[model samples]
Target: MELLLVEDDERVSRFVRRGLEAEGYSVTAAQDGVAGLSRARAESYDVLILDVMLPGLSGRDVCRQLRKAEVSTPILMLTALDHTDDKVECLRGGADDYLTKPFDFEELLARLEALARRGRGFSSEPPAVLEVGNVRIDRQSMRVLLDGEPVELTAKEYQLLDLLLSSPGRVFSRTRILNKVWGYDSDPLTNVVDVYIRRLRGKMRWDRDTGWIRTIRSYGYRLDPTI
Candidate 1:
């Protein structure tokens, strides 16, 4: 997934860009709010990570402008402030999710994933059926079967699987997955995608027994090639 990260701190920006790239995401960084806004307006992105305190424009202002301009890309707001009013202000300004500094990378990734899912209009209601390779996901009843046997999956695991199956062979960056699955705005230092990929492999990819959900290696993930 393509993402725009608007942050002023060079150190923070580099750290985040590296982390997101490691998770196989394509990220564009803007040093301040003005440049960030310009980049956002100039291109299409799956998500935006905006810092509350910006040089040219505040994160809140950027969100406000985006909303005013009818840019529907999901936004995750970042800030060091943890006050309730501050959170409210950002949300009111149009941020989908808010995060304070010193956050758990895992939690941030989860939030970002959740947001992406929401943006894609994924149904909370279970699906009737999901088929990927020899595995089948029954959304209506929240059941998964591999090789005709029941397979256990955690809630997050099921969500991730459903996401992959829904878009077979489409590359999904770590940031994209994080927003769609976890509902957060940004995570610059998390290896959450790798962690979850490992978990999914353990559960779904049984050696050569199952061959779905291939990693693109430094890009993201895709479902079985056949879609």
Candidate 2:
């Protein structure tokens, strides 16, 4: 995922950039709201994280301006304000979500993932079931089926398959897979992704060379639904 982080505090910006980079997100940081606004207008990102307190312009104004300009990229506001009115203001300013200072990293990650999945803000629509070939997954129920038969999958396996299904025919690099499935703490050198891919194939009754899952020599894997 590509992200734009607008923050003034050096420490906070550094910490967020490092953490997101570790998770396979390409991030660009801006020190003030004006620079952030410029970058945001100039480039596209999967998401934007804005600090409420910023130099030159305030985060609320940035969000409001982006919305006014019809930039639909999801925005997550970070602030020390914890009051209900503060959160309402952030939302009213067009932020998709709000996170308070000193929050748990896990929560931040979860909210970002949720926002990305939700797409373009707090959408009210539910995700449609994803299917490729004979494999299908119901996002609402977290159910997987192979050839119309229910297939029980481990949480990790389910997540891996879901990622592939999310974008059929799009190759997912190993680093990207590791960060998305196993997280940043997983050893970069570990072959666990390979092992799990094999396991997922076996469970789905896919032969090594004749499956929808294709290994992209030395790169990673892709789900070729057309197969």
Model 2's lDDT to the true fold?
A: 0.88
Each prediction's Cα lDDT score? 0.81, 0.88
Per-residue lDDT over 1-227 for candidate 2, one digit per residue giving the tens place of the 0 to 100 score: 88999999999989999877765578999999999999999999989999999999999999999999999999999998899999999999899999999887667877888888777555556467987788889988889998899999999999999999877867777867887888764475799999999999999888778777899887789887754
- Tally clashing residue pairs in candidate 1: 26
- Clashes per model (N, Cα, C within 3 A): 26, 0
Question: Model 2, stretches more than 4 Å misplaced?
Answer: 22-24, 67-72, 113-128, 138-160, 167-201, 205-227
lDDT of 1 by residue, 1-227 (tens): 78899999898888888877765568999988889888888899888999999998998999999999999999999899999999999998889999899776656666776777777787655458977777788888889987799988988888888888877766777767877788764488887877887788788754423556677777677776432
lDDT of 1: 0.81
